[model samples]
Target: MRRLTAHERALWARVAASVKPLPGREVPKLPAVPTPAPAPAPVQPPAKAALAPGLPRRPTAPTTKPKPPHPLGASLDGSWDRQIARGRLAPDRIIDLHGHTVATAHGVLASAIVAGDGARVILVITGKGRPDRPARIRDELMHWLERPDLRPHVASLRNAHPRHGGSGAFYIILRRPK
Candidate 1:
């Protein structure tokens, strides 16, 4: 092979000088310096900091696992009146989403269901659409209730009673709060 040019040799020498030597070299190893032991962390007392001079600090609220939304259109397989009279079911809350737009209704429904407030049954009044003028909310309510965000709050949905607007509304069974 031809010898490297002067410029090429000089470049190689600079590169070699900057590079660290690989392991297994013949260089003598120096005695390892002993590292000083880490100082123990300062002890801190477990105490709540006072918010005011006289008042004690308020305790933090306990963490709780949120209840999952219930699915939509789940069958009850029983009579509504009998269930209600027997204390098995009671629709304590009602939300009328009749005149509201789809977006507004959806937001309201989601918020209502999630808030729960110890209500066992909630009546969602979605007015039935006429044959010529279809009620978009009525058709889409169940589909919206089935969504991941709202499904956890609703256990099941059924047609409301005649006194409760019949086909124009639905009964949303909210899951019992843990």
Candidate 2:
């Protein structure tokens, strides 16, 4: 190769002088950049109603009236007398209104009333008089019959026939509602 001319050599020397010299010691490490924290999530309020169209309004409260007392109590007292005098009621449909528990008796009576308005004859089996005790099934039946709620609905009530249950059971006749 031909030797560089003096002008070309002078240009190369200037370029070499512009470049930085490598450090004698190892290059210093760059400082670490800190990572930014994530932004917090947005909070939302509870919905009182739906945002969609045609949605129904939410209910705020209940809407109903309390029931009134039953009207059957007064009628029960004279039901048998009226039936006997006018032949308005029959005894053949008597049902045995018997149960060991008070709840059962009440349920049976409620169901019987609902079923036919007490037109059907029911023989309630209250059980024989409790020995050595005055509180018997028969007595409880008497108490239930005496309730004001049940009186008006009862057409007639009497002791059961001997073959049916004697004093242990009662024949309850329900009246048809007018």
Candidate 3:
């Protein structure tokens, strides 16, 4: 065994002192952390002053008038017109284009109209478009209806009555299969 040097002896003495437990003393406990207070909410701005001083502010009427159910078609034949007006021309089949992409809607709509089977009037429900993106599917569908592939299958197209779907949907009249 090698004899300890003077410097090594001092280091060992320090280590021995640290390791030795105090006989009568308890270990000191850590202090609790203080939590910070929450920030105050921002105050809202006051309402604008009325136009006139004393006169009560007249309730403003709605800017746009409510549109009546206006049916659109290629010169509706007498009986068909009467039936449509009376809301008696109920759709034999229905297809909703909600949550479908433009490409998907195009393919599905074309296939549905082409394979309309025995249905005379097919109801197409393009949900009243998102407030952010105006009548996208509805406009696309209207344009799609004019294309050669889908056009042959369709005889007439009309805006559905409020009961059916209002401005958001169309009533597609399918041609009789030969």
Candidate 4:
């Protein structure tokens, strides 16, 4: 080996000073690391509340029984007559009249008279005839009465007075005939 110059020796000494050597027993070794596991999914609870009060708990079942039909003529009574005098009738009576057939022209004329004369409580016999075409005429008459022109004549209406046709007829009470 060649002998170093004073400048080269000083440079070598500076480089050697920065470096360190570990003793055999003082050196450290890396420890083994463990991997982490995934978390489980959440669970949901079952339904327990009632849908509505007084209603059946099961959706497939009904809560109440159906009502029986009323006896024939049972719905007709004196109060109905008073209602007729007022030119007003119940929806049930109007529905019943749907069965009768007074001539369209005659019905129109009668409606006109009822309106013009202020006739209170006129009996309209809508016969329970023609099962194939029930209540056709009565329905027509009721429709006609509802027209703006005829409305002035009618005050109120009700099912036929008990003495009247009951379900088969109607009692139309006109506004005091004008």
Alpha-carbon TM-score of each model against the true structure: 0.53, 0.41, 0.56, 0.40
lDDT of 1 at 25: 69
- Winning candidate number (TM-score): 3
- How does residue 107 of candidate 2 score in lDDT? 67
Models, CA RMSD each: 20.6, 31.2, 23.4, 29.5
Cα lDDT for residue 103, candidate 1: 97
Better of 2 and 3 by TM-score: 3
lDDT of candidate 3 over 5-119, digit per residue (tens): 5556666666665664688976444233334355588778788766777788879889998986433366457798678778888898889998888899898888888884788
Error of 3 at 76 (Å): 3.9
168 in model 4: Cα distance from truth in Å? 1.3
Task: Please report the candidate that would top lDDT against the real structure.
Answer: 3
Give Cα distance to truth, residue 43, candidate 4, Å: 17
lDDT of 1 at 160: 82
Predicted structure 3, TM vs. truth: 0.56
Q: Rank the candidates by lDDT, best first.
A: 3, 1, 2, 4
Q: Rank the candidates by TM-score, best first.
A: 3, 1, 2, 4
CA lDDT scores, all candidates in order: 0.76, 0.60, 0.78, 0.53
